[model samples]
Target: MRMHEHPTINYPEYHWPAGKRCAVVFSLDLDAESPFLWLHRGQQVQQLGEIEQRRFGPRQGLARVVRLFAEYGIRGSFYVPGVVAQTYPGLLPFLLEGGHEIAHHGYYHERIEAIPVAQAEDYLVMAQELFCTQTGLSGLGHRAPSWEMTSDFLQTLERRGVSYDSSLMGFDHPYHVGNMVEVPVQWTVDDALYFRYTNSPRDKTHPANPGAVLDSWIEEFEGVRETGGLFMVTLHDWISGRSQRLRLLRKLIAHIRHDPQVWWARADEVAAWHAASPNRDLYRVPAHSINTHFESATRG
Candidate 1:
């Protein structure tokens, strides 16, 4: 199909709960040391510096974040890898006590693209079970580590009774991806793009200044507000829980709170509202349809 000939659908005006004009979700990837452990699963962990850096997330960073949330009197979402929770033991209870939403990240913060689809599904099942076992919370939401997803993985989410998946970036607002409520994410607003700085040679650039990143995030928030979209800020505990970054977060929260029309919500709350609202089917974009379109466009 030609560019203009491609199929199109009319997306109704997205709505926020409580007559809010726009939505903002504060979500944290409480990754801790799971990602580093995943990268060196079998080999001996020689990168002690990086591992210790990530460990700071659970040891000190998360506590600082919890204090900040308490100060703001707002609840946020915390997506935890199974390994991190298991290692910390008290992590889930602490988050629950803080009135935060706990969602599934991965078993070990494994990248779905690097493993077989079956293995990835197994990890999902394992993580879900672990979360349920520890917190007694079922039907939790998921956000793929590294923001990666596949058709089979999406299907697994549906079969597992997942309330929503916040990995895809199809739209700034929540939409369906094959019957799953997709709470879209963008790298521009995610902290890893700006704050993830390991001393590894693979690092091509230095970490950005916290002030500059806060300015860019505020600019993006303004744009999203103007467009009446979701401003989902993804932060990692290790990367964004530092003192300077936390100050930036406080400023951002203060600025957002100034706007009375904004809806500050957790990820699952936004997903629930979208699932029940008129916008549910209005913005549906199933993954299979996109695969078919790509195949047709690239035909020999």
Candidate 2:
């Protein structure tokens, strides 16, 4: 009897530019009042508590975050919603002026599952139009609002010519989702999960300590460095812009700088490098389901 032969599984190694051991992307979701407005759409939001708290990002938090990045000479990426850019006309200009990359987030931090694919594409078009009108540039990167991505959403991204997306958590480094380059993000490293608080019963756990969060992030960075993967930190301006959190971030950046082998880059930079490198075809995932075996697999 002859045995079946299985092909060898290929695990491709990610090679960072300049031969760095790892890549680091300090990304921020520059969501100001867009999330609040989205949540209260079609109704009167008489309460100012959440609105004011979210507004802090635009009025003060963003400036603080930008200043810190400037101090560290880090060109971080800012994912902005169309509503945010429209509400604050100077936002795009300010980010570009700071030598940072402005990527598309959504029209209103929309929940992709609630809207149709056409609506989602329309949101992307609106965001693209806003970016071009304000900054005379096209968006090369996108990170879905709330980190939600469906097959339709990913297809919409491809149709709109978005070069890359940062919402998926498939791989620590860059990979391909259909035709779109994916710069993965982890919830554990996202600032909102640790710092976001609304003063409501929905709050299950208190915000984590800033020092502890910094230590965890540093440990994650070290671990990713050892694996030669990407350490993509997702921060929210409203959450991480506080004085204490900013200090934590500053300390973390200082610690990261101590290692010169990390490729500190923006999301677009990593995506572009990945798309152009041999890794483009090595790590691939389908954007949509290719088979319908889930029902059978889960049936009792």
Candidate 3:
């Protein structure tokens, strides 16, 4: 398959001059299925498993990820499911106290694209309220469950006061989705897709050698840095928390710290800068790119 290209935006009125060459946005998607698995079994089964449930349960993997982020002094955006927050209120406080941005993932880890607009909107509202009540912080950002989103879904996010989203892949920088900004996260760097897609009788799901994954990511990060572009890595707590995968994460972080150009930042902060900096012009996408779906969806 041909590589995907980023989208281009023409906003002369609001466009700012380019600022930094690249900004790195690390996002942790915190959606797991359990207790409420029966609510959306068909959809949830593809992305999670019972063993994953036991590993990623509140006390096991999630907390470890929280501590890792804190240790790195890197504040990341956590796209959390509302049900997860409700079940583990203490986790919400811990994330807030440690200074991370919380974004809406979904109410129960269900794919919003499969549901009707009215139903999706209701779920989004419930998720926003649940997150705010449990974490004492209102979320203005969203990432769809399983990175599965549609034009209607994006419209819903705009109408519901979500400031940005990070579900789409194939971009090295952030761009606007209608009036809301889209902090594009390259799913190629995402562990979930890498592991899940590679799972076959002939191919192992997890990387045969974790170092190879780290090496690939580091090479991408270095190239982005060379061009003064952003490097965003997406991962799920359930997958990356595994012994082998966790080591890859450590190695990747170490490589980033060793680099002089890398600026480890929260997704929200990257959005803020992209909105404020004149250098926003630096994030241009080729006109013929398929990733221009955001622009096409809104224009239609």
Candidate 4:
């Protein structure tokens, strides 16, 4: 049979709650060293320095991030992989105690679509279960490890009662995938593409110019503010927490915070607000980009 073609995705206008002009979500993927392990698989042990670099997030960078957020009174959202949460036991307690939101990231930081459907489901289940076991409640949101997404995996999330997901860039605003909302994310807002560098052959990213990143993010803020859209800024403990990158992040935050119309919220809060609205499925965006094609093929 010829490959099935999904209908052209429609771009619909979506609004934020509370009369806010822009909903800004500081979503952190606390992948730590797990991403390197997931990306390299069996070769992770060979990339010792990369592992150490990744560890910098939880080891020292996390404190700095925490301090900055406290200074700004921002209750940021953190997506913690279960392995990382288990590896660093004190991390989640401090985050929760500080009024931060801890969301589910995979268990082993596995790429959701790269693994089998059962494995992907297992990763999410383990992550969610561990989060519940650790915090005595469920995490309301999920940002798939490396922002991976698949239709089947999305179905899993909906079936398992996830309120929202942040792994897909389906639109400039949140849209429903069945009952579960997708709080969209884009690479332009992700810190890993702009930061994260190492000497290892497996290390492919280059250090982005801080000034350029700040300008781009600020520009994005302005554009999103106009639409009253959700500005889902994706950061990683290991990348954006670096001192130099952290400085850039500070500037970006300051710039966005300067606008009184910007609503600083956690990922789960944004998701929950969107979920509570009956208009969640009110808009739809085209998900058939080149990336979606690759994703569809991969899922097959």
- Please name the candidate that would achieve the greatest TM-score relative to the true structure: 1
What candidate 1 gets wrong by more than 4 Å, as runs, is 2-6, 290-300
Residue-level lDDT of model 1, residues 1-300, one tens digit each, is 433322666566788888888999999999998888898899976658998999899999989988998999889999999888888889999999999999999889999878998898888888888888888989999999988988888898899888999999978899998799999999999989987888888788998988899899999999999889999999889988899889999999999998998998999999999999989978877566533334345647
Off by over 4 Å in 4: 1-12, 202-205, 284-300
Q: Model 4: per-residue lDDT, tens digit, 107-136?
A: 888887788999888877887777777778
Better lDDT candidate (3, 4)? 4
- Sort by lDDT, best first: 1, 2, 4, 3
Off by over 4 Å in 3: 1-19, 34-57, 196-207, 279-300
Question: Which candidate do you rate higher for lDDT, 2 or 3?
Answer: 2
How much lDDT does each candidate structure score?
0.89, 0.88, 0.70, 0.79
**All candidates: TM-score:** 0.94, 0.93, 0.79, 0.88
lDDT of 3 by residue, 1-300 (tens): 334554344434323223344677778887655323735466645654454554463656667776777777878788878777777777677777888888888887778767898988998899888877775566468888878777677778888878778777535567665555778877668877665332335445545466677878888887887766678888777767666776787778777876555667888877787777764555444423344334323543
User: Worst ten-residue run, lDDT, model 3?
Assistant: 11-20
What TM-score would candidate 2 get against the native?
0.93
Model 1: which residue pairs collide? none
After aligning candidate 3 to the native by TM-score, how far in Å is the CA of 224 from where it should be? Answer: 1.4
